[model samples]
Target: MSTQYEALKNADLYSTAFRVEPPTELGERKMTPRRPGFFITRSLSGATDAERAALKTATASQAEAPAANQAPDGSAPAPAAEPASTSRLLVPAQWGLVPHWVKSASDGKLRATKLVHVKSDNVGTSTAFRDAWLNNQRCIVPMQAFITDDYRSGGKPKPTRIARVDGLPMGVAGIWARWQDEDGSELLSYAIITINANAHGLMNRYQAPGSEKSMPAILNEGAYDAWLGSSAAKAKEFLRAYPAQKLLANPVEKGRKNPLGI
Candidate 1:
C-alpha cells in the first residue's frame, strides 16, 4: 500500500474542486498515516425533530395574535432556503480507519497506522471496515497526489508522487468512521480505497517485484456527490481503477526513510 501522500496546499482548491470551503489554515503538506486531513461528505442541513417541536409550540402562541409580517408557519419544519440534498461537508479526519469496536485509544493508534489503505474487494467483508462500509459512511479524500515507491532502479526504491496529468486535484474514494470512548471523546478517521493495478500500463511498475500491484481508487470529478450518497451495495461500482494514462508520476524529495514501506 502507498502509505504517504501530499495534501492540497491551496485552500481554494477544496472549494473549486470539491465545492466546499476549506479551513483558513490547512494541515501538513505531506500527510502520513495518523495525520489530520480533510474529507468530503454529504451534509444534511435541516432542523432536528426536537428543534422543530419547539418552533411549533412558539408559532402556535404567536398565531393567537397575528402581527404585520409574521414568521413562517411551523407546520413545515424545513425552511425554503435550506441547503439542497447535494450539500457537502468538508470534514477534517485522521488518515486511518478506527473501528468503533476499538476498546482504547492506544489500541486504536496502533491499528490506525496499519489501516491506511483498504482493498476494494475486501472492504465489505473485512471485520475492521465492514461496519463502516455497510453503514454507507463513504467519503471523498481530496489530495494533490499520493506517494509511492518505484522499484525499477534495482536498488533502493525511489519515492514517486502520482498526480493527475491535467494538474488538477483528485478526489480519492474512501470510507470514514467515528469512534467514541467511554468518556464521550470522539475520534474520526478514514482510509483510502485501493484497487489492483497489476494490468495498468503505468501503475503496474510501482511497489515491489513479486507482490500484487495496487493503486488508489481515484474518482471522477462529477461522481463525488453520487459516491457519498450511494448505498452500501452500489458503492462498490465506484471502486474501479482510474485510467493510468491520465496520471503522471514524478520523484519527490523527502528524508532518508523506507519509501517502499517494507
Candidate 2:
C-alpha cells in the first residue's frame, strides 16, 4: 500500500530540488491509498487564467447543453465548452464529506461536519460513504507530496515529507459527493483513503512509537486504473498497500493548521 513517505516525494522539498513520479518511484508494485493520516494539496483552487481560455476554446468538447427538465451532471454539464468533468471541483473541497442524508449542514455530526478523511477499511460499511463507493463516485486526489509523524525517538517530534522520485503527479484514492444545502447551494466533498505503514521510511521513522498503526492507502497509476475502472473486484484490489521500498522519506517542517482548510 502507499504510505505518506511516498506521497512526500511528490512534494516540493526544501531540502533539495529532487522530484519524483509516482509510477517510476514505486516500480511495478501494487499500491493502495493511505490508511489514516495522509497529505492533500489545497492551496490550488478554481480554474487558472489560462484554463478559462482553454475552457472556452474547448467548450465544444467539454460541455453540452442540458435538457430543459433534467439537471446537468455536475461532472460535465451542458455547453460542453466548459469541462463537464468535476475535476475542477474535485481539486479542492471544503475538506470534508457531507452525506446526502443530512437534512441540513448543522445536522451533520462532528465527524461529518468536518470530515478530513475516509478510511478504505470502512468504505463498504460506512453509511455516509457506502453509497458513493458502490456508485462511480470514486476519484483520484492529485498532490505534489505529503507529511507524516515520527514519534519513535522518545518524544522528540519529527515531521516528514514524502513524494515521488519522478517529477510526475500522483493520485490518491478518493471518494466524492455532491450536496445541496437548504438554500439550494450545492457543494462537492471528498476524502482520501488510508492504510498501514512500511519499514525503512519516514512513516517508520516518524510515526509515534508503538502507536504506528496506520498510514494512507495510495493507488498508483496502475492500481488507479483498477480503482477507477469498471470492475468491482479490481477496485477492491486497490484497498491493499503497494510495496515499501519504492518510497523515500525525509524530515519536514510542521506548519500551523489551516483555519479554513485549504
Candidate 3:
C-alpha cells in the first residue's frame, strides 16, 4: 500500500453524496407523508402512490363548502385525520440522522449535516445515535454509488466513486430519528452505519491522507428484510465491509464531472 493510503487508513474521511433511484415497484408500496422542503434534488425517489392519493383527497375536500355539521359562522373545519403508518414504502429521507432531543431545527440541521455517517462501533452507545439504535428506528438507505478520495496515485489524492459491480442499488444499513421543533415543524433524518475498513483491500485505497479508512455497512440483497426488522445486536452482525471483489472504483479529475454523478 502507498504511504498516502497507509497514513489515512485509520482516518474518518467518507463521502455523503449518494444517489437514490427509486424503482417503479416502490410506487406501489405505501409510504409516509413527504415533508415540504425536505427533498433532495439529486434524488429520483419521488413521492409514493399513497402520498399522492392523500394529497388528491385533501385537495378535493378543501374545494367543497363547509359540511352541514359545522356552525353557520365561517370557522375552520375539523382537523384532518392523521395518516396511518405503513411499512411497505421506501421514503427518501435526509442523509443525516438527527436526535429527537435536539433543541431547534436550525441547530439540528447544522449538527445533522455534519453527522452523515455514524461509527458502527459506537453507534449503539453514542449520545446522538444510541436512542434510535436502541428503539429499532432502523432504515435502509438505497444509493447507486458513493464518493471517496483515492490516494493510491501516490501524490495528491483524487476523488473516486465506488459502486456495486452488479449494477444494483446499494442498500446501506442506517438508523433514523425524528426531531420536531417547538412550533410543530418536524424533520426526519438518518445516518449511514460505517465500520472499520483499514484491513479491507478495496476500502483501504480511499480517503484523505493520514485519515482513518472507513466504509459504509453495505448490506446484501437477501439481508434487507432482516436488517430493517432485526434487533440492534442482530443488525450489528451485518455491519461488515462489503467484499472488495464486488466493488468498482474509478478516479475522476478535479473540477470535472463527479464520478458518482452526485
Top-TM-score structure, candidate number: 1
Best by lDDT: 1
Model 2 whole-model lDDT (C-alpha atoms): 0.47
- Candidate closer to the true structure by lDDT (higher is better), 1 or 2: 1
Worst 10 residues of 2 by lDDT: 14-23
lDDT against the true structure, each candidate: 0.77, 0.47, 0.56
Model 3 segments more than 4 A misplaced:
1-87, 253-259
Q: Write the per-residue lDDT of candidate 3 for residues 4-82, one digit (tens) a residue.
A: 1110111111111122222223221111122111111211123446555544443343334222121111122322322
Candidate 1 clash pair list: none
Model 1 residue 74 CA deviation (Å) reads: 50
Q: What order do candidates take by lDDT, descending?
A: 1, 3, 2
The C-alpha TM-scores of every prediction are 0.81, 0.59, 0.67
Q: Could you tell me the lDDT of residue 97 within candidate 3?
A: 68
Candidate 2, residues 1-262, lDDT tens digits: the string is 2233222333332111111111213221111221222222211234466435433433342233221111122222222121132112123343457776678866543445445466667876788888777765776665555566556566665655565555444466777666778797765666767766544343555565565345555555433333554444456666555445545566564463421112
